[model samples]
Target: MTKIPAISLRRLSKSFGDLDVLGVMDLDVGRGEFVSILGPSGCGKSTLLSILSGIEEATTGEITIHGAPLNQSGQPFAWMPQNDALLPWRTVVDNVGLGYQVAGRLSKRAARDQARLLLPAFGLEEFSRALPYQLSGGMRQRVALARTIAQGRDMLLLDEPFGALDAITRTELQLWLEQIWGVDRPTVILITHDVREAVLLSDRIYVFSDRPAQIVAEFEVPLDRPRTIEMLAGAQATQLELDLLRALHVGSGDTP
Candidate 1:
């Protein structure tokens, strides 16, 4: 028998009054799969993430995870938005443990303890007591990631988690994220504008058209993981990147 998808969106659409953002979208993210939704900025990509996370409701259609209605179920999905959104006054450990405290119903100390165990993996062990302002942008993102994982969620919804970092830092975090996901594959739906980032991290990629957005094409990343930036320089990965780029361009009515 076929395994149920980790996430399923059917004929989903969203609008703000007269302005439609997503128009009749459908998507499936399989169990333990890493999928990326790549599109140009302001194409309702982040809006889609918000809708799936229940931060925003779809105007029409349904969202399900594991065959259960997403909003109706006590869905255990973690959402990490573009900004790290860390509390400035909180120490790293406290910030990283916040989600665990709320979702896992652990005491503050217990939450900190649990989060501490994950700090080293996310490269924040040394800064556990440091404030968010004391850390770099990338470090803050790591803490946010650790916090998301602390919730013990099986699905991760990342909205350009590394989008604001410097190029080198973003690349490093992408590799780190892959290593974590490789070991314990949680279903991931990453929204990103970077084609190369999508190619490097995703098992499959869905390219979306401009506003009133919908998927225009999908590509399977042919490279095997433990994928590396070096692998992205190879012919197959390059071609995939070019193909995605061309698809985005064409979807936006630009000549490739």
Candidate 2:
């Protein structure tokens, strides 16, 4: 039996006045699959995500989630942007529970209670009362992630969630995220600039072209999971990375 895709995009396009950001693009993400959109800085990756999340409208397209048209009531996706975007005045617990409160699905106290229970899993139990100003960048992102997870959505749209972090911290968080996603198996669509990050974290990767962005190539990562950074050191991984790099270079109108 074929499983219907968790999300689908057909003839999706976005424009800003005379400038086009995303050309007519078609994509699909299967249930429980980790997919990545790998592209350059301004290739409209975030724009596509915004459209999926209903933060922005597409100029022309058909978007479906779980076989239903977009905006059909219960949200099929949750979004995590490039920045942590935690509230400065809110404590860690409060920040992590804001989603539930905002949804009116739970009271603030109930939301905090839920956040408190989940904080230990995120390694944030000790800092429940800490303000955003008191936490490191990595910790703040953890709180943000906890908030996103608190929503219990089955699909996640991550726009370079670890893009702003340092190398070591990013690696640590990526491992932690992979572990969490492995357990939950939420369908994920991640937008990223790092080739290795996409290869490491995704089941399949779509490399996008320059402006008026569209998928130029796609590759499946054949490695089995519970994947670690150490696996990326092998010959196959190196060649795959080189291939992705070449695709990006070629997509940008440069000879690889």
Candidate 3:
């Protein structure tokens, strides 16, 4: 028997009044797979994530998780938006545990204890008691990521999680994320505009057309697991980057 996909969308579309954000689209994410959605700005990449996370309702279509209908009550995904969005007043640990506290799934103390255990993995152990204001941008993103991971959800919807950082920091976090994903293997759908970022991290990539977005191309990255920075500089990876960049231009209707 075939394995059920972790998430599936058929004819999924979204609109706001007179504006259409996403056209009819069909997509699937396999269990523990890392998929990236590449598109131009305002091309409905974030809108797709909003719909999947239940923050926005779809205009039309079917959505399924593990072959069953979506269950909004279950809160099946952990989402990390472009900005770190950490609460400045809260300590790193508190912010990390905020999800559990808000969901009433654990007592404040229990939540902090659980979050504390995850801080070391994200390199935030020493800063557990530090406020968000005290940390650098990269560190703040790590805390936000730790919070997302603390939820223990099976799916991660990352909407440009590393987009705001400087190039060096972003690359560091990318490698860090690869290591984490290798260990935990949660199903992931990342939204990014960076061709190299997509090429570096995704198991598969789907390029979307400009506004009122629809997938225009898809490519599978056959690179080996435990992907490293060195691998990204190889001939195969360079070619893949160029291919994805070409697709992005095509999707945007630019001469490539």
Candidate 4:
């Protein structure tokens, strides 16, 4: 039996006036699969994400979710962006629960109640009262994840969610994300250029071309479950890295 994709992009194109960003791209994210869009700086990775999220409208093509059109809702599913973007005025608990607060889906107490229990799981038990400014860059992102998770979004669109953190902290959070997201795995579409990060985290990766990007290649990481940083540091990681490098070579106009 074939599982219907969580999100499908069929010949999708996007442009800003004369500048074309994405050109008739087709992408498939399977149900509960963790997929990453890997490409270069100016290749419109974020633009593609924005178009899919309906934050930026596409010039043509279709983005459908579970047989329904996302054009109707404009913004459906959950979004966790490149920046932590935690509100300065809100404390950790309030920040994590902030989405519910804005949507009026849950009262203040109830939202915080959920955030409080989930905080320690995110290594944020001690900082519930702390403001965003009081925490490190990495700590702030944990709050961001906590907030995103609080929404319990079924399809998560993550744009470099851990891009800003230090190496050690980033590794810590990566493991945390795998654990949390592993349970009740949501259909995830991540935009990242970090090859190892993409390889370590994703089930499959979609590589793109220059400017008006195309799906140059797709590679399934054969690495088994319970993955760790150590796995990425070994020979298997070396081979996977080369595979990713070759796929992304298309982004640089490297013909293979």
Candidate 5:
């Protein structure tokens, strides 16, 4: 028998009054798979994430998780948005544990203890007591990710988690993220506009068209896991990057 998909979307669409944000779309993300949705900026990519996270209701569609209908009664995913969104007043450990506390799943003390254990893995052990204001942008994102991981959700919804950082920092975090994802293998759905980033991190990529988005093309990355920066420079990776770029250009109605 075939294993059920981690996530399945059929005829998914979203609209706001007179504005349509997403057209009918279908997608499937396999268990423990890293899938990226690549498209131009302002192409309703984030809207899709919002719908999946239950922050926004879909205009029409069906969404299933593990072959069952999506139920929003409890948190189904660990969502990390574009900005780190760390609370400035909270220390790193407390920030990481906030979700558990808010959900009443753990006492504050227990939550912090759990978050402390995860800190070393993210290279954030030394900064456990530091406030968000004291951390660098990259460090803040790490804390944000640690917080996401602390939730222990099977699916991770990342809405351009590294989009705000500098190029160097972003690349560093991508490699770090790949290593972390390798160890735990949580199913990931990443929304991004960067072609090279998509090719480097995704097991498969779905390219979307401009506003009122629809998937225009899909590519399977076939590269080995624990992906490194060096691999991105290899001929196969380079070709995949070129192909994704071409698709993005065509999807957005621009010449490549």
Candidate 6:
């Protein structure tokens, strides 16, 4: 069966002032599938994301989510940025619920009640009363994911949510994120500079070229579901990673 695409981009293109930032990009994301966009810096990965999230406009293209066009203001989708963006003064529980509070969508009591419900899942029930400053980096990212998950949106646009973590923490969180997303099955488009990280998590990866970014290659990740670091040593995963590194070389300029 042809799975319904959660997001569809047809002939997408974008430009900044006089410079072309993205051009004639085409993409499709099936419902509940996790896809990653990998590329070098200045390839408009962020710009493309801005358009997908409706944070920025598309110069020429179409974006459809669940078969409907996305209007400005980026509704029906939640975006988690590279930074957790938590307020230090707020309690962990309070920070998670801040989304509803700022939107005036729920009363403080209701919001906290809802946010409190997620504490156990992220393993932060004990730290609910603590402030952001009191939590470790991994814990802070948990709070960020908890906040995004709390929104109950069907699509998640994750822009290097784990990039700032140390190697050990990053690997641990990769497993954690895979568990959550696999269980919930929300359509996800992750943007990351770490090619290895992208290889470990995505169903498929879209490789982009520089400045006027466009898709140069797309590779299907053949590693089976519930992926683990142990697979990191497996032949299939290694081959896919090598192929992706090669894909980045398709464009002009320095690439590794």
TM-score of each: 0.97, 0.97, 0.97, 0.93, 0.97, 0.94
lDDT of 1 by residue, 1-256 (tens): 3888878899999999999999898899999999999998999999998988888999999988889998677855899988888988889999989988988899999999898898988888789999998999889899999988888999999999999999999999999999999888999999999998999999999999999898999999999979987999999998998899899998887884
Model 1 residue 123 CA deviation in Å: 1.3
Off by over 4 Å in 3: none
Q: Model 1: residues >4 Å from true position, as ranges?
A: none
The sequence of per-residue lDDT tens digits that candidate 2 reaches over residues 1-256 is: 3877889898999999999999899999999999999998999999999998889999998998888899784777788878888999999999999877775389999999888998999999999999999999899889888888887788888989889999999999998998888888889999999998988899999999999898999999977798899889988788889999999998888784
Clashes of each: 0, 0, 0, 0, 0, 0
The residue-by-residue lDDT of candidate 6 on 1-256, one tens digit each, is 4765788899989987899999798899988789999988767888877877778999998888777787743586788877899988899999898766654378878989988988898889999999998899999999999888877777888988888999999998999998888887888999887888998899989998877988888988989889888987899988988888888876535654
**Where in model 6 is the C-alpha error above 4 Å?**
1-3, 72-74, 102-104
lDDT of each: 0.91, 0.89, 0.91, 0.83, 0.91, 0.85
Among residues 3 or more apart in sequence or in different chains, the pairs in candidate 5 whose N, CA or C atoms overlap within 3 Å are: none
| Regions of candidate 5 where Cα sits further than 4 Å from its true position | none
On the 0 to 100 scale, the lDDT of residue 256 in model 5 is 50
Expressed as tens digits, the lDDT of each residue in 189-250 for candidate 5 is 99999888898899999999998999999999979987989998899999999888888889
For candidate 2, report its TM-score. 0.97
- Displacement of residue 187 (Cα, Å) in model 2 is 0.6
lDDT of 3: 0.91
Instruction: Supply candidate 3's per-residue lDDT for 39.
Output: 97
lDDT tens digits, residue span 92-183, model 4 = 99999886665438989988887798898888999999999999988988888778777766778888888887788878888888888788
